[model samples]
Target: MPVRIGGLASGMDIDGIVSDLMKAERTRTDKVTQEKTLLEWTRKAYTDVNKLFAEFILRTRESFGLTDSSSGFLVNQSVRGLKWIRRATVGDVGIADVSARAGAANGANELTVTQLAANWSAASSDGISAAGQSRSNLASQFGLTDEDVVHLTISTGTGTKEQKVQITIENGMASVIKTSYGAGEDGEDSVISLLSGKDISDLSLKELTRQINRADIGVTASYEESIDRFFLQTNQTGAENTVSFSDE
Candidate 1:
């Protein structure tokens, strides 16, 4: 048969066929690089979400008058990676878990931050009771408030005789209010009795967080149990990554 070339069976263009194969290989490589880039972006999105969660937890703890101790829930994730090969879907890199106390003081305490008066000042007289008028007026003039008072218990030495007292405030106003019963069997719960007649007002949740942050409580505010994922928009051609949300 006479030599034939072109139209699918051209053994005449073997080199050209090889060149075309190389071009296809390069195209595949480019696609792989694109997929990798997408994966990295998605991973970063997950990390940012977790960081935000941490910040919120810290802020919440500080607002609740937990300055001496760090409070709030801590979360972590496991098993994060690309789920889909074609569209390049990614999953949370780790297992999601919370860090909270195992018992009693378990959950987050919802409270706001307020300024504690340095002394018996006038500004602290906002809600003074009738019997507290004279003292309240004097405290207001000097810039003291009720929140400054921290109740404590004192022992009388020879026996376990304990007495409840408000040390931070003036000596006589509401200090050393004994909690013992006449029977001498046992004293009233000193802490409870000290706080029985006290009235406390806390800032709203939102305002409390603001105050905590303002005080530089060393903790940031963040959202917890949030969903961090992105969606790919489908079009006539195919699907591609779109906007991503790092929270629930």
Candidate 2:
């Protein structure tokens, strides 16, 4: 390119005119570049919208179990089917609550509750200890002797499903008496000592209750200090569930 020296011979602002022309050309080029960038952004937004529509269509087809060859997509065969909007209603909300799933039977179903189940429980008829008596002195109240061995069998369940847990007390300590059955005959009984070497005076009702609960023989034993009595109950609540205590 040849360099042109202006304003030397023309005595006019020739260099300023050429600079203004170049500025106008740069402005036009910048406008074209901005338009191109805006077009690319618009194309990208349309592509994203198309992808979302495609995903929604695929999920709808999969939900209705429709294949590519299916002519139309209708949930449960018909658009206005009652199965699509199946709902359950209870007559008395306070008594019971009901819920219905999609495609459930449309009809009034009756439910009647006759009785409620309850757990079997037994409590001492008379207070074992006097009011305000210390719980640790409960053994003395029972008149337990070192030579005396008290056997208590707690039987649960009915018929052949019956289970027995025999508790034997000696020297104020209670233990689970495990018996072995050999060929339809009663075998030797083994004693699993719970509180060994504990004297009658040293034994507490609270301690005995803890030992019985720890045994996990389907029976819960608790001593009420206020009433001064022992309460025994089965862990489950049903007619078949029973807690029978046999003192032999």
Q: Find the 10 residues in a row with the least total lDDT in model 1.
A: 229-238
Model 2 residue 179 lDDT score = 32
Candidate 2 residue lDDT tens string, 1-248: 99776697668888799999999999999999999999999999999999999989877765654424355753334433333356788888977888765667667788998876767788899788754545665466666667788878766664335556666677666565433222133543333445555565776777778767765656788988777889988887767676666897
Q: Ten consecutive residues with minimal summed lDDT in candidate 2?
A: 178-187
Runs of candidate 2 exceeding 4 Å displacement: 1-104, 130-134, 158-162, 171-173, 177-193
Superposition TM-score, candidate 2 onto the true structure:
0.50
lDDT of 1 at 207: 31
> What are the lDDT figures for the candidates, one per model?
0.36, 0.69
Q: How many pairs in model 1 have backbone atoms within 3 A of each other, for residues 3 or more apart or on separate chains, i.e. clashes?
A: 29
The best candidate in terms of lDDT: 2
lDDT of 1 by residue, 105-203 (tens): 423433343643221111222332233233223243234466454443322211332322222233313322333323254733533222223222321
